[model samples]
Target: MLDQLSYKDKNTFLQNVHTAAILTYLAALLLLPLILAHPLYLLGVFLIGILAVVVSDAAQECLPFLVMGIWVAVFVMILNPLLVQNGTTVLFYGPELPVIGRLRITLEAICYGATMGVRLMAIILAFALYNAIVHPDKVTGLFSRFAWKSSLVVSLATRMIPSTARDLSNAREVQQMRGVNFSSGGFRERLKKYSWLLEVLLLSSLEGSLATAEAMQARGFGSRRRTCYNRELVRPRDYLCFLSGLSALIIGVYARFAGYANFSYYPQLDTLAAASDLIWLGVIILCLLLPLILSWGWKHWPYLRSKI
Candidate 1:
């Protein structure tokens, strides 16, 4: 069942999406604040990047909820500049509200929010790619070695949401076929009508849970330690890929501290004029090109491969 929910090896579109998504997260984490001050700018970059990656991935299955989850996390955590609006300089006056009074939008707050947003987006995209590409069985197997009960619970819980959503959609279709009018109603009525669907879906899930528990108990599922298949091989390509990601992360951190890439909001000023920006930009370009460089080296030079 876990394997059935996992990405197939033939899903190159998913692989490409995963790659793009990962790169987008990494680059945005490393570059967004270097170039932009507004939280909206970071959000725009993330939206465009996600759209491009997912469209490129173009898998038959639609994971709209997962995508929505990403957005929800972003909006709640990173997009709310209101939480961190503190600086000596105020760039603009936000509209006055009854309880909040006139809000001040500071440059520092904007940059702060943008940075936070980029960081949150990075984590979300990385996990989203992992979920989209990596097999859940593989993840379960990996996690089980560390903590079996916790791993299984998390895996099951993660699987549960999608499964329930699928069941709900099917239930709605059946209700529609049975002459139930879901569309021609007020918002409250529409919601009230869906209660029937939700009830049945919950019942179905409860049954599934019972069946799964029974099947597991019968098989003595936890009596012995579970074994995992070694499907992921560590090739030279993987090492190069990992090293490149590491380099990007490190360079980003370095640039942040060194003032090559920075964010400031004080006395109504937001500028990045450090000399390190040029040097680090070159370093980032090299880091991004490392994969192609190593690939080319592998094909053309046999003796030079010792360094790789």
Candidate 2:
């Protein structure tokens, strides 16, 4: 259970799925949030993202990101009403300030902000799910065929996030052992204590990077004589996933072009999608979730594999 708290991929079917296949599905999953502005549609998309995280066993690992995204979404919700004053229905009107002018909040701005918030949450959860299932090594290797150094840098940066958190935890423990009390201080004093931790974290990160560079150099990394490693091969299952993902992607793109996925919130809010429009959204979601459905069946009904 403790292992679930970290972003380590388990030997689950979703985790073992071909990287390109999963990425194709991921692209389709992200497409809805990017083009759609209907609050209900975006909310549905975000809910699917949450479901994916739960199904992929990423709810725990992605908890921090979920919280952060919510905060950011709330910030958008609050900031938009203050910044934008273009709406037919005015909710609040405050006295004018010098440079900022009058403060006005409207239903349109509020609805738009909420829609944007939902969009952001959906996108963030998509990434959180990807990080949970996809191995950094696979991502690096996949892109390395094109840009080795750039891929390596990106992979390193992604991996460093979890390791850096662990390092900070270790540093906190060491400080506690040395009679340094971090939680016993007031706000300002606690900030000072945290500043100390940051200093230690920075130094350790720099030293670790230097050591990695030295080790790589010693191993003749990037040399012409470097040997090939075992490569990830695509199976029939991967191809199926890719096809389903492409199907979903095509549907989503068509929906956007048909304006079935867009909503208007400025001046006045547009009515939610009609029942006919929702059919496309439903199909897109079904296609996006095909991998999870397959994995569930594969895991729970072992005899099905024999038929396959």
Candidate 3:
């Protein structure tokens, strides 16, 4: 993510795809895990998002986020089983703690943890893909017309995360050279070591904020009326991408109302007895893949690019 964005020089399909279409595509990607709790469905979407990162040639830019997501999800998965004692299928009856009584790990609890982890992974992938393909300026321009402040905030956040991560990494390395072992001790010891890292990160963030404020003031951010120098143009295939995203959203809402996407792991995992979700899943996949498919097609076929 710290790598300079090279999306423009590539002349890939994503750069040509409409921003509205991409946002809608992302909307569908983000909508699934919120309303549905099934792990397989969520995993399917997450895998496809990874494919998107690969196809968009953003592996370098997006992989750190993917790795970070995996770490967080794994932490959640491991932590959930230790805390929740719901479910009949006993996996492990852990030791008693002071405040939290006996730790009873069950199959249902594990499944629920896995489901939650996968849901988070899917969400992270969606944001990573957005950061990879969509230009920050594009996002700023797209939403600025309706919600300038919101767009500005979103744009800054999207741009800031990678930089902040890079800063944290550098700070860690510098501390290591100074004999600060971030990974060599027990949990509490390591936590104390990180205090210095956190301090450095906080200072770096403040410096970045100051720089941003200065730059914005120099740009006349609040001096006068704003103008969009680079407006997006919606093309024919762009409409198709937009429509596909809207269709996925409709299908998802319908599935939610019909209870096709609902799953529970408390009593036990829900039986995969119904095939109704298959049809909706197919629609969702198509809608999810449409922009990517079109982009791939346009890139491979010069004639199609002329028309799309």
Candidate 4:
């Protein structure tokens, strides 16, 4: 699916950038969201996640996961308040339940849950975008330069996700053709039908694994020092991008450690009003957005040059 949607023109900055730079950029993205607890900052992270999905050309594949993330977020918002009954500002009172005495839904708990939900959604979207942009073969080849055994393991692990999804879809289509009505069935019946689907998928995976093993053996995969046919060179622009990402990561980490981006929601929601916080926020946003800017600039360089 990603192969089908990927841009035909392969001369973009993102495609040319060193894998190390890409890894650094992704690491910063994944870490910044986890460190910042402020709702506004979290919103920035969420927006970055959305931007990543759009830039990666995997929005169609990511939509379902985004919807599922929303559902999970709502579930967390509802469930957290029940489990954690802490806070002064009570919105409602509930009957005393066994094992847990009194139950009250407070504003703090709700806020905490919402923050947690947003954090989760941002992380999921970020990873989805990463998966779309970075192919398993690229990762495998990257690791192969270091350790062939590790490379093989990473290859299998990364390929398993898309392969399993594809197999499941194919299995469902074949089953439907054979008069297996998965949609129009009771809970038990649906479960049974899905079990058969899983069985078929498992068989398909085994067959693929066998074929892959045979191919690897035929190619003498581990017999010699592995060499990549297509090597990505780190250009001057790649250095600039890597340095920018590293600097952003350092600043973001410093801000987090210095408590500039900290927010509390347990007993009461607390936020810092220092001017430095806002500056750090802007820096983080720029850091997250730099790649998109570079990609778009390279994408339209010819058109921009024509005007000059």
- Say what the RMSD of model 4 is: 4.8
Window of ten residues with lowest summed lDDT in model 2: 1-10
For residue 195, give model 4's deviation from the true position in Å: 12
Model 1 poorest 10 in a row by lDDT: 13-22
Residue 124 accuracy (lDDT) in model 1: 55
Task: Report the C-alpha lDDT of model 1 over 1-308, residue by residue, as the tens digit.
Answer: 33434565543322422243334434544364344443333454355435533533523332543465557656754445565557866777878767757777766666665556565564455445455555566556655787999988988998887788789989999999999999888999999998999899989999999999999899788888776656444445555656665676576567656666554555444554445555676675566455545545554676645444
Candidate 4 structure lDDT: 0.76
lDDT of 4 by residue, 11-92 (tens): 4455456777777777777777787777777888788778866665567756766888999999999999997888878998
Candidate rank order under lDDT? 3, 2, 4, 1
In the range 1-308, model 2's lDDT, one tens digit per residue, is: 33443458566667777888888877766877886666766787788778777777777788877898999999999999888889999988999977768988899999888888889988988887876888868877887887888987997887787789889999999998998899897999999998999999999999999999999899888986445587877776687778888997787778778888777787788887688578988887787677777777767888754432
The candidate that wins on TM-score is 2
lDDT tens readout by residue for model 3, 1-308: 34634344356677667888878877878887676665666877787787788778878887788899999999999988888888989978878988779988899888888889999988988887776777768767877988888988888887787788889999999998998877798999998899988999999999999999999999999577888777778898889888987887788788778887778788777886468877777777787788778878887888888898
Q: Would you estimate the TM-scores of all the predictions?
A: 0.60, 0.78, 0.75, 0.78
Model 2 stretches with alpha carbons more than 4 Å out: 1-6, 92-103, 156-220, 305-308
